[model samples]
Structures are given as C-alpha cells and as structure tokens.
Target: MTKTDQSSAIPLDTTARLPAVTYVLTFCIAVIGSNSLVLGPIAPEVARSLGTSVALVMSASAAFGLGTAASALLMARHVDRLGARRMLLGALLGLAAALALSALAPAVPALALTQLAAGVASGIALPAIYAGAAAVAPPGRESRTIGVVLTGWTLSMVAGVSLSALVADLVHWRAVYAVVALLAFGAFATLKTSRYRDAPAAGSAPWPLAALRIGGVKPLLVACAAFMSAFYGIYGYLGDHLHSALGEPVSANGIVALVYGIGFGAAALLDGVVDRLGARRVMPFAFLAVAAVYLGFALAGGSFAFVLVITFLWGLSNHFGLNVLIMRLAAIDPARRGTIMGLNSAVTYLAVFAGTTGFGPLYASQGFEMAALAALVLMLVAAAAGSWRLPASATPRN
Candidate 1:
C-alpha cells in the first residue's frame, strides 16, 4: 500500500486524548517482562522438578534470549505489513500458549523449547506495543505515554519477581508460568475488545536493512546497546555480591529491588519534562545520570544502606535514559517504527546476553566494585552516543 493510503487507514481520534487501551498495553508488557525474568528466581525449583542441573535450567533463559533476538531481527518487519493490533493479538495468543506449554513441559528440553517460543512471541509483541502506544498518543503526550508503558518493567521487577518466588515456594515453580499465561490471556482479551484503533503500517521498503540507513538510527541503537548491557551486567551479579561480599541476606536484595522499582515507577511522573524538552536534548544528560549512578555503586559497594540508596537512584536515572531512547527512536521515522523498534529490541536482548556473559569473569575475579566500574564506562559510552546529532526531521515534536 502507498504511504498516503496507509496513513488514511488509521482512524484519528477527534478528542486527542490517550486511549484506554494504553493501560492494557502496559499490562501486556508487564506479563511479557515477567516471563523474561521469572526463570532467574525459579531456576532451582525448575531444575529439581525436571531432574536437571541449575545451570541447565538457566540455559533455557539463554535460549529464550537467543530466540527473541533472532525473531526480532527477522520477524519485526511484519508489523508494518500486518498492522500493530493484529500483530499484537497474534503475538499475545502465541505467548499465552507458549507459557502454558512451559508450565506443562515434562522435561528440561521441553521447557527450554517452550520458553524459546514465548521469546519469539515476545519479540514481536514488544515492538507492536511500542508502535501502538506511539500511534494512539495525542500530540505533546508521546513521551508521557511511552513512560507510562515503561513502568511495566517496574511491575515485573517488583510484583512479578516477588510473586513468582512466593508461588514457587508455596505452590510450585510451574504455577508461576501458569499465572503469567493467564495474565497474558487477560491482556489479550482487554486489547481485543478495547476501542483503540490500529495504526496502519507506513513503511514500504524492505525494513531490516532499510531502517539502518535512516538518518539518526545507528547512534541511538549504539546508545541502546551500551545502556542495556551496562544495566544487565551489573544487575546479573548484584544479588551474589550482596550475599558474598556484604554478608547480607536474600531479603536485603529483595529490599533493594523494591526500592529500585519504586524509583523507576515514580520517574514516570516526570516524563512530561521530556515531552517538553524533546528526547534529543534530554538523552545525553539522562545517560550521564546513569553513569553517575554506576559510579555511586562502585563507591558504595560495601555499605548496605548506601547500596539501597544508590539502587534507587540507579532505577530513577535508568528510567529516564530508557524513556528518552525509546521516545527518540519512535520519533525518528514513523513509517519505519516497527522495524526500528524491532532492531531496538534485538539489540536489547543481545545486550542482556552480552552483559551477563561478558561481566561474569570480571565480576568473579575483580568483584562487584570492578563490575560497577565497567558499567560506568559503558554508560559513559552511551552518554557519548546519545550526544550524536540527529536530522532535524527526526526530532520529536515538543
């Protein structure tokens, strides 16, 4: 279809208000994020249940990451051709089914395969969710809308993690996936029935390669990589550091996570500042703030109280960095949003793998202090990339 024709297909809301469906998108994101993180907390239980080693069970998470990265790179272009709503519905259905299968898997390999399927669905669903959010947002409210959706990560970190651990202890590990499956189904139903209009696909070019050539795409992606990698690398080892170095209990780590989630969720209130300042102007400072937070981590790694405080700041700064990165990418090219976001998600999953694996040896030998320094360096790199200039046309409207 022609660009003009594609634009015409999307029904405009005369009132210019954010749609109710945005909340459903947030819920969907929470469920998807939960699936990605659940394995970490429940790995031991899953390993015991399947008669496998903890490392083997954990490998399922890696399989899921690989599936997500591969599918995002290869399948995200379909969002433009299929329309966001249709793509999202299909993805949600697939996710629900995959999670259900995960819950029922009789062996470790079956669980890994099912989780991989879930990851593929997630790879598609996330970009569609982002594109749909941007599509339905009223002018001047794009960043705020995206920020609201991003709080879903906080939900995953707080409620999803805590509840999964509880269920795994009190009930069974499989129940965690079962609950997530139900949540996914619930989100799918809400979205399917909501009054939200689907944004028509705008890009006609073959997307995977075409999106990279777009002005301002590459730098933002680099920033995304560094940003995500830094966060995951430090996060992957935080619990171990607390237990081994500081002699803190597991509950202390949970407290840190809760405080961080509070900061992340609270930062959504300031997203309007980005909407006013423009993502391009806000991004570098946001990334710099994250670098500063990492420096704090390096300095305060020994004190539990200081760690708690720094973790909160870490979440707060990271939220702003995430908000700006996504807002900028979504604003860069409306026609190619699906592909751009797909690439963004691809880089994110790959970074998750890279961060954990790359930081493992350094963290093991040099300890948490050095890992924090490593993350600080990466955040500095992200800050520099965020400073790169974008085409005038690619800047988000203030």
Candidate 2:
C-alpha cells in the first residue's frame, strides 16, 4: 500500500483551507451528477418530442439508474486497480459522449441506450471521486471532507436542473444537454492536468461484495437500499407531477427544479448535524422523515406551498441519512473501504432503479402520492430493520 506524510497535504479544517482542489473535483462530481436529474426537468419535453407517454419517457431515468447500478456491481472495483485519476478521466469522457448522443437521439430507445452509457460512466465516476477525496483529505477531517463534497450532489439538483429548464425553454432541450456536455468536457480537461492522488491500496484484492455477509453489514445495506428506494422514487417523477398539477402550458421545469433544489442547497448544512448525532442513531428517523415528505408530496395537489416544504425536508433527511450510513459502513472494515464504497454506490443507484421502475405504473394509475404511500411502507420497514442492528463502529464521534 502507498503511504504519504500527512504534513504534505493541505489541512482540511484550516482557516486558510484548500478548497480549490476539492471544489474542482466537486465541480466534476456536479457535472456527472447532472445525469441524475437531467431527465426529470425535461421529461415532458422528451415525451412530446419522442412521441411517448410520460411513463415511457421517464423510463430513461430507470435505464440510467440501472446502468449505474450495473457498473457499480460489475465494474466499480476497477477503480482501485486502474487508479482514480485515470478512471475519472475515462468516465468523464464516456459521460460526455453519452450526453452528446442523448442530445441527438431520435427515439426513446436510443435515448435509453445513451442514458445507460451515461449511467455506467456515472457509476464508475462516483467511487473514484470518493476515493480521490479520501486520498486528498487530511486525517482528522475525513468525515467532514466527505460531507462537504457530497453537497455537490445536492448542488447538481439546484444548478443542473434549474438551469437546464430555463435553457430548454429558450433554446432547445438538446441545447441544454449540449451545454452540460461541454461542462463535462471542460472538467475532464482540467482534472486530467491536476495532481489529485489515486486511492492507495495493497496489490489487487478480491471483489469485496462478500463482505456484505458479515454481521452488521448486511442489515445496513438492506436498510440503506430500502431507504433510498423511497427517496429516489418520489424524485424520479417529481417533475411530471409538478407539471400536471400546475396546469402550465409550458413546462415550468426550471421553476420546479429550482424550488426542489432550493430546499436541498439550503439543507446542505445537514452534514454537520449528521456528524454530531452519529449515523446509526439518526438514519432511521431521517428515513422516516423521507417517508413523510414523499407521502405529503404525493397528496399535495394544488398546494404548491406544501410541495416546497416537502421538497426541502426530502433533501435534508435523505442526504444526511445516506451519508451517515455509508460512513458507518466504511468504518466497519477500513481495510476494505474502497470495495465497500463501490458496493454502496451500486446499492444506491440500484435502489433508485427499483423506485423508478416499480413506482412508474403506480404513479401513472394512482398518481404520485399513492406511489409515495407504497414507498413510505418500504421506508418504515427500512427504519425498523435498521433498529435491529446498529454497528458498534457507528457510535457518534462527537
């Protein structure tokens, strides 16, 4: 395993902190993150242009999630052997190509294929980015460093979707994607030249998925998957639901994206709270909160104000809860941190696929709230399951 003197790296919590590198990588993280919300803002436009139903149009989200999940399960381990910097550059290039192809897609099937490509790239990018963060972070502030960087996901929701919405209105939906593609390309170019370190590890290790079979690990994964299913399910269809309820002739996708993002961006500070409470103690309640907000969103109807509140709470709890779970899981076997991080990414995206896929027909037939009610049931189960086995490593550090 490679080792570096801590004194050589930037102090993570210093008054004059080293945010440039973190922020640059964070920006790259945000670029890939656009794929997660890209279809949401443009769902209505994509359906109309491609001549498909809303449910069918949104299937692209499922395809993307599935691709990401598959990559996480099938290919993420390569991040360790291949090196994070190389993997990141490769993934970003692939993502750019996928988005470019998505811009020119003539049919829903073509879109799905390209989205799958993008998802796979994203799946690959995540672990590399996280590993890169750990490599660069100072010793004492590992959790805090991760928490700050994760805000990129939330930031993507705010910036990527909101801007894409407005851009789609003025230019073309394809144009919005083209711009995102450019951002990805630029990030790739910058990252290629930077000095970010690779994740240090002993010579290649076996794939670590079997580690999940250990005592507290399996339950945490299940609880995490269940919790994620509920959160991602509501978010998948949030745009279409908003468009239908508002009765706006034009899709106010920008407005919808912006409002949801506002909640998330504002709530990005929840990382501090999670740090203090410890994930094991706080995650179950956060999952319950996710369930409640999603349930409220499903029944919100014309009450735009209620939707706003629900969106904010959804951002706060899910981000905080999920981060805690991953951190706790990584701590379970520090030696296998890289493998566990990859598996966690796989589970997260796969749960999103489950949520989007299973909930689509229900969302079509019964509306978003009813589907949310189903997700709520799953969240309760996750909460209960989580209560059964809190890992000793997960005690609050604060």
Candidate 3:
C-alpha cells in the first residue's frame, strides 16, 4: 500500500465495529443529498405556493447547483487547513440556516437565493464528509466504508424524495424544507457531539491547480466528468419521457426512482469485490457496465417493465462506478484529498448542469432514444478514460 493510503487507514482490532462517527457522517451526507434532490419532486407545489411558473422554481435548483460548483472550486481547499470536522460542523450549521430560510421564502427569487446559500454550504460539507469517511475507514476496507456512506444517496432518493413529496401533498411545500432543516440540525448536533476528529494534513497544496498536477488526477477527473454528465443528461428528462411518450403516471415515475434507489443501496453488498480486486483494476469494467445499461435504456425505452428492470441495473452499475472512482481519488494523495474531492464535486455538479441543458435540444428534436444513445456515447468515453494506464508513480495503490 502507498504511504498515503496507510496514513488514512484506521488500525482496528478484529471484530471491532466501525466508529460511531462513520454513521454520523453518513447521516450528514444523507441530509446534504436530500437538499440537492428534494427540489425536483416538489417543484410544482413550490411554484404553486410562490405563485410562479414551474420552470422558475426549477431554476432555483439550477442556482443551487451553480453555487455548489462555485463554492467547491473556490473554498474546498480550506478543509485541509481547518480540518474536516470543524469545516463540516460550520457548513452543516450554514446549511440548516439556509434550509430554514428556504422554508420561509415567499417568492421565487427568495427561494432561489436560499437554495444558493444551501448549495454553498453543501459544496464545503460534501468534501469534508468524503475526507472524513476515508479518514475513519479501517485498513483494507476503504471501498466498503465509502460505499456505506454513499448509500446515503440511495436514502435520499427513496426516503427523502418520496417523503418530501408526500409531505408537500399532505401539508405544504414549505414543510419539506422545514423538515430538512430540522434534519440538518440533528445531523449537526450529532456530529458536534461525536468523537471524530480529522486533523489537517501537513504540507498539503494550497491551490486546486496543484491537485490537478498530481499524477493520475486528470484522467480520473475526466472519467468522472463523463460519467456524471451522462447520468444527469439521461435522468433529467427520463420522467418527462415516461409521461409524454409512454403515458405513465407521475406515481409510476416515482416507482422507477424507488426501484433504482433500492438497487443502488443493494449494490453496497458488492463493495467488498472492489476492495479485493483493487479499484484501478475494476473501474474500467464498471464504466463499461454503465455504458451497457445506457444502451439498454435506448432499446427498452418503450416498455415500462423493461425500463424498470434496466433502471435497476443502471443503479447497480452506477454505484460500483462511483464507489471505485471515489476510492481511487481518495487514495491518490492523502494531503490533497479535500481538494481532489472538491474537484470531483465541482465536476459532478457542472456535469449535472451540462447534461440537463445539453440533452434538452436532442430530446426535443429526436426523442428519448436519441438522448439515451448520447448518454451511451458519453459513458463509452468514460470507460476509455478509466482504462488509461497510468505510470507506476501516478497509479493509486488500491
């Protein structure tokens, strides 16, 4: 193992349980993920409540993504200086305040501003959460540990999105944000009282540019960009296609999302395979699997049943791809993990924007099949980038 990997690995006795702080970090990620995803399901209700168009309400989500990308690129390096625990605490507090403000927003502009603030907080918190996850991982189990934390995304999809929609229907759209605010507050309190302490790394780079210069960083990031862009591009318009093209109801669309989340969470059982095989060895195949899933989407877009099955496979492949990519990046340079992960988050959100916007014209001109094909092309690019063989010095010791 590389010295960087060894440094982050926690020595544990046999049969010792994971640190409590690990679960706390997972909850923190779940809250952050929920905030990012909640806007989608509740957009119509929010628009109705604010007396605005649905598109305008959705623009608030775009604002959040923009803010998150900007903050991650600019401020994430601070985690290396301030320490992950401290940065996370402050960011969570900021997120809670932003969510509360979002709950009280009476206008679309106000809601957008609040979401932007929340995005800023999330940008900082996500990298810290990732770095903290790595820092707390037991030796030889890094992939599985990170995978456990990533299931927070699944939770956000299944429980967070579903519950927010239900709450908005049963109560009010504002209640969704209010409840998320309370959850953020709870996460903050738990983390604050926990024993997790991720001390700042010594001799870390001061700028993201230096992290880019690190061996193996550029290609991995290239793969990350392609991977995330493909996903958001296809996913952004999937529900619309199902409703318009296939005559599926809104509830049916929700079922697809739920099934996808179940598949994502279930794939955590296979994280140990990545640990045993090494991420560098497994990532190429994982990307290819995602590409195949996209191709399946193109072929099966007309059949709701087939689409549901393929969506499950999509979630499973995506989980493995994400897990391996993060494992490789976190193991690349311990000192620069915060910056590296920040870059990852920036690329991801930027891709979210790119995919959503880029695929719109295609989806409009041709149809969902064409968009699916386009996503397949991007995933192929990701697979190729992931397959690049780095020099021995640049390769992560997975």
Give the best candidate by TM-score.
Answer: 3
Go through the candidates in order and give each one's C-alpha lDDT.
0.86, 0.71, 0.88
The lDDT of model 3 is 0.88
Our tally of clashes for model 1 stands at 0
How good is model 1 by TM-score?
Answer: 0.94
The better candidate by lDDT, 1 or 2, is 1
Flag the better candidate by TM-score, 1 or 3: 3
lDDT of 1 by residue, 288-394 (tens): 89998888989988999899889899889889999888877877667777888899999999999999999999999999999999999999899999888656665
Better by lDDT, candidate 3 or 1: 3
Give the alpha carbon lDDT tens digit for every residue of 196-274 in model 2.
6565456774475775654566777788788878776776677677678666533454555566656655655555555
Model 1, C-alpha of 20: deviation from truth (Å): 0.7
Candidates 2 and 3 compared: the better one by lDDT is 3
Across 235-316, the per-residue lDDT of candidate 3 in tens digits comes to 9899999899999998887898899999899999998887666777789999999999988989889999999999999999
lDDT of 1 at 140: 65
Candidate numbers, best lDDT first, in rank order: 3, 1, 2
TM-score for every candidate vs. truth?
0.94, 0.82, 0.96
lDDT score of residue 343 within candidate 2: 83
